[model samples]
Target chain A: MLSSPGGNPHHPSTVAELGEFGLIRELTSRLDTTPSVHLGPGDDAAVVAAPDRRVVATTDILLEGRHFRRDWSTAYDVGRKAAAQNLADVAAMGAVPTALLLGLVVPAELPVNWPTELMDGIRDEARVAAAAVVGGDVTRGDVITVAITALGDLRDKAAVTRSGARAGDVVAVTGWLGWSAAGHAVLSRGFRSPRAFVEAHRRPEPPYHAGPAAAGLGATAMTDVSDGLIADLGHIAVASRVRIDVRSRQLDVPLQMSDIGQAVGVDPLQWVLTGGEDHAIVATFPRDRKLPARWRVIGEVLPPTGTPQVTVDGAPWDRAGGWDHFGPDQD
Target chain B: MLSSPGGNPHHPSTVAELGEFGLIRELTSRLDTTPSVHLGPGDDAAVVAAPDRRVVATTDILLEGRHFRRDWSTAYDVGRKAAAQNLADVAAMGAVPTALLLGLVVPAELPVNWPTELMDGIRDEARVAAAAVVGGDVTRGDVITVAITALGDLRDKAAVTRSGARAGDVVAVTGWLGWSAAGHAVLSRGFRSPRAFVEAHRRPEPPYHAGPAAAGLGATAMTDVSDGLIADLGHIAVASRVRIDVRSRQLDVPLQMSDIGQAVGVDPLQWVLTGGEDHAIVATFPRDRKLPARWRVIGEVLPPTGTPQVTVDGAPWDRAGGWDHFGPDQD
Candidate 1:
């Protein structure tokens, strides 16, 4: 099971002891406001200065035991991962992340330090993305649930949608591939080596700037790798009505069965193909366009023949396509 | 105990049978778009045009068995109640509600039609507030949770904050006082009567237009009465550093021992004074200002003597202030 931060097993204060308002005061006291936040927490509603006259917004929820487990992820990891996933949505839209609204539901017996640490993780990640905690709500629940909404500005540029791809476009990715899935495999197998993979799974660092940069570079059909590379790409393919084919060799990774892979007893390549939660941005660019230094070409888009599909080496690689919320395994 | 809309007890399709994407498509297909929603659902992020260059944002969470109960309310009631609470926060800011993002977490066995009914409730309430659904996230969880984020525009008017109440300002309220609390009492004691109270509890109809109307008439401070009249007024008192003395007689409510009150054997005034979830607008105006037809004066702000406190009839009313998230009852 995941351990608390202080090392010693001393009992910590429960939320019940502090009360709702008191707990909120303690948790929000650590938040650092940014320039765009005209008003922060404690108000009925927060007023944010949206200088662009347009705001891009998206939301995501993380449920205890579903999206995460206390035994697998620390409280801070949960908070950081939650923020990363939502912010990645804003990035995928070719917008600059600006403000966030967090809603937390927790059990009464939860230690007060857990929520404080979670807020610390959220604020820390927001700082890296230059966003601020504009508002939040706290309530009691049977289990912990975190719902976050991230807002961004388009800065006068058109938002890149998954429907903009065309044939004869090179498919490229800006962040690490299969790392988060690899880390998940390691954790699931009860083995935690290869520090990078484990860390990647716990706290993803999405290439925040690369989204707007790709938009500036005239990239088409952009989306963040959330439900595995192939699954997310399938969304782009269907939306853009284009066929996408990936060249496995083009992915710059040591796909050989390593110690961690052998310990997990799963094909590393399978993880690379269908593993999710990486938060990497995959986009299609005109084949003749010069690629940015951070982007690596991994595939190309083709005109749809019958139905949009994502293939590897011109053949369908049928395996687990990724997570489906209410799929058979869950129920 | 809530019965499905179809009346027949035929087995409804479970969420698992539809999958996440399919369920989302079915649920969101009926959402109506507004002019402010430049980009609506189905995208990674929704782009909302904020012509005022400022956005007012707030969030709230409703958890099953905590904030709501299926045995007492239907899916549509839950959805409408969720939207009403968050939109009330926007109105408390004296802004025009613009858009909303909803995040839903439900058990895999939940009926597919339940979410559709919930969406219908959310959209109907949002229509009254002139807001539209922009984007949302859905996930699988053991219990039902709905987290909503409401966005508004100030339209060049300064946002009315709880910290602006000044001494000699008249306190006013618009909307029902204790109907929701009384409704809660009715449901708790296994008694249902006074259809008005029960309906109020199931679906709060906040005076959405009163907030901006009061702001136009020069309201000094404003807040929604989500936490009993005294408790919410206490928030203004603490934030603005002013003492608020509310006249119990001026509060328009039937404080007599009604049938429900006698059955529950609790003071109706207790609910009027400390009961929450009414979603009424509690605001302050200058003492000499002519009140609008929609506003009723209940008290006046006074300069703080030592510390800010909310008094009733110029005396301290010692009772339960309001609901506490992690109170003794919960743990």
Candidate 2:
């Protein structure tokens, strides 16, 4: 049911020929909308309902090859990852994700189903987050890229931020760490993994409720472990102007795929210390507050010791460090 | 300061070699943050302050080649477009734009300056919108793609939406239309145009405040015209369950680039009728309300005809239809 140049084509030519304006026109032509939209498509901005007065938001983008190999992860995986990351942000804000809008660009030669699959992934993730895929824009590009924005409902709780951590706060984690990193190590080395580790690398199941739970429990500060534990914890440390010290003795708990580390002769502690992409919930609580289940107290926040840093047993745990989009060394 | 595989080693290898988890770790390891962040990177989600309790939000994405030409538009242009679209979305929502989060994916071969330029564009746009670029993520991919999320402040007004149109409401527009479409025509046909039309095609200037103005005026339903007027109006009609009728006679305003239309023998009416991307604000208002200075009453909302559609002089205006991402035909 595809039309080419000869027949009345259903879709326009490459967005290049349409140019940005024409492409936007062709794409948005038939969208039926309402007053709840306040502003629909064109304008310096759009307005929407924020009855609670505060909006919860987050964003994420997925790239081809690095995030998903065309041969390995389907467009659906890309879409799911894109949406999940943003939804996780909303959850991190101690909000319930309510809506999402996506931006997508792909090569013209790519199969049309590719985008549809991606949308399916987006829809699937939205369902998990209890959010709706409200709207989006699409265009042609050299490679596939998916950008997602997630809006969440805060339910009026005070937002938990990183700066609130005070001395004597306990640091805890709600999900596994380093599984994704270890999984990547196995994948790159061409080694196989048990289902759990591979799945960790593919679709991270974030503890969405932990953010609000921590907020409700009066968490002084909170964050997701998208980066390695040490690195991410360092963020909390720097933001709170505090020093964090983790005790490795507290980390030998049962894990979903701990054996994967053994298979590779890799130290599980290293994975937990430096692995990222697990999308787990980490937060600081006053010493007296009870933590939610699965959240293990692994460290404590102290007044900054001249320099803000995260360490293991009072010493900086040396590792390759964390991710940076444009590091000084990045080309 | 570039890292290279050989030679002076400018940047490093492609992201695939570093792997997804590793890259993320490296990217996030060194970011400095503030206390308001309640939650920093690495968690189920990040928590930021929304002291006012009400929040505004919008999202948009840009693809390589489709929205921009690597040969023509710089990465900065791509970033600008991305930020502009989302900021426009926020304005459409009748909110004051505030903060932005970006997501980017590109081939490792991309120059580092490309992303820097993109950030410059984002920062510049944020400055124009009085917003801040707070956080973002980057990954390696085959093509460059940018996704931007914009957050806004409602400043205490109820969100204006598209579904509020009622019978006897006046239909009005706040920005120019068809210029971008006309500009696209000229660019596609390889015809040089007056600089205005070309510029309109390259970078659209959406009327930022028309959204909040409509909200202030108690406009019932609203939407930005990313799609053509008729198509986007159709959205309001469907959502509001009302029929919208526009009088073309009312739309015969002076077009700065009408010469371009005459030069190409293309009906300027076609551009006005179906062209998109001139992100104007269109809203339906009570007949008694005073119209804003920039807005022109173009039509009226009425009881739905069996078929929901826009009409000119009681008949459907035949023209090239608006854009559809997955429509069966292609031009």
Candidate 3:
């Protein structure tokens, strides 16, 4: 068993009481794995089956107080959110996630149950996309930080990149948008009755299958909505050298969210157009193509406008650059 | 481009001044890629070819104050050390390193030159192992934390796990041992005259070719010596259900190291046997095997004695469990 700096192994409650190896055992034992894991934990490295001959990989780091709030999110909620973000990135590349590895830094005085529950959430989240927890590393740090790297398989299909969109293509998205932001507004006011939005902020349900499905249906370009719709679509516009115009009327702003925005004296459309972390999958298809019911048409591609790359109703969204994860961002 | 919170982007000296996208561009542009990386950066995920149908992966996290001190090492040295630690784990699995992904957390006020130079170090180190920097994520945090995940190809060979060693096997090792520890001791004393030793502490040169070579030579078991030798071998013994005995007489303590030991009133042998972080390779082979000149025989496997799984010259090493990464570890 691995020793803890000053922990008593027999007590086995908090990290300082249980020791290091016990923490590992508690966290790893809670993992639910998939068949692609050729070698699990307990080795210098993990071996994962990659049948497609190529692996798709991405990584994300989440820090407490910045990416999440301990008072607002449980360990389980944080874990699911962490895995969902990176796994959604893999899916955005038109691949199916197969494995996840984690690098965690925990405060030694924290309760061991926190990490065990966190892994439980990670395991369950991975199972949603048929992926497995293969390996990870844990160490002591001043604050709690989780770094996740996800690997995926393309399954013989060419990856759909962000730079493939062409003028005259139509833009669409599958999965919830602005719900997390609306939830944050609700929680910011100290009200939790609208549990749906709060829960959405805590655990995002990404449409993982939509990515490869979009690729199969001949998607021209794709990206995940981690950075708001206009901003993310702006990336596509810049990379593809085209202009993107979103019809604000086409966006779906639920009554509850609208009510929350009204109560807070903010525009609900602002949240729908901007706000991040919902992990929604957005893509562009040929103008003549038929889209599935799950995809909501929101915008269209056009020849580049000299000044603005992304616009709403052929004009800039007045506050487009006013708020984002990049500007004194707290959530 | 991603906006900075409050600094002027045009001034671009610190992370706060350069903005997020500028940071990404600076770091990604410095990378030297390999042919196996079908898609490198600038995407939702990276695609790497895995010809062996199985991918070997490992991850490690290095915190600034705990794993490295800015005053003691440069960002480049920290980057090299972080990459080396994870890459060595992949090598221990009898695989050739192929790609590396990173998750970094940096303070916004930190200089922009730090991460750019850090990427240079990572890129050069990956080049040494014939690997590429494929993808990564960076975000703002209160403290600096680097998390690296390395992927490798096995080339159709089965993995050599720790449980494969048997009694009557000869133990051997390749690469520098205790050099980092001696260097650490030198630096701890506030003296920097021993340039070679201090450099070893800053940058470890892992034998990239030794692992696969040992596998081809029919090595029964293998692992990288990241933990102290006896501590890491103890893991092997427990997993393989055997006993291991090391010969202290066989160890070669350089004259300079012994002289440093004498001046510090410490035994150089202690550093050779118990010091960690000079990422050397240690493996077990059958007694009849003919090894290459690079491999040095140092011990032998024997039946389990139950109380002490690993010993030095037929008895306990004297202070096996008293010192390790798990107990009051500073370096």
Best by DockQ: 3
User: Which pairs in model 1 have colliding backbones?
Assistant: none
DockQ of 3: 0.81
What tens-digit string does per-residue lDDT give for candidate 1 at A1-331? Answer: 2234234355347878667887788778878998889999999999887888999999998888778888878888888889988889999999889989999998899888788889888888888889988889999878899999999888888899999999999999988777887787667657786778889988999999998888988988899998888889999999999899999888766643345556655556676777778799999999998987889999999989764399988888756443322121211
Collision pairs in model 3: none
A17-67: candidate 2 lDDT, tens digit per residue: 445555444334423333234444543344444454556666677666545
The model with the greater DockQ, 2 or 3, is 3
- Give me the runs in candidate 1 sitting further than 4 Å from their true place: A1-12, A255-265, A320-331, B1-12, B254-267, B320-331
lDDT of 3 by residue, A186-298 (tens): 78878885889989988999999999989888999999999899889998998899999999999999999889877876677788888788999999999888999999999
Q: In candidate 3, which residue ranges exceed 4 Å CA deviation?
A: A1-11, A320-330, B1-11, B320-330
Q: What value does the lDDT take at residue B144 in candidate 1?
A: 87
Provide the lDDT at B281 for model 1: 95
Candidate 3 residues B15-66, lDDT tens each? 8877788888878878877899999998899999999988999998889998
lDDT of 2: 0.69
TM-scores of the models, in the order given: 0.92, 0.76, 0.94
Writing each residue's lDDT as its tens digit, candidate 1 over B182-289 gives: 887777657776778889889999999988888888899999989888889989998999999999888776743255566665656677877788799999998888
lDDT for B19 in candidate 3 is 76
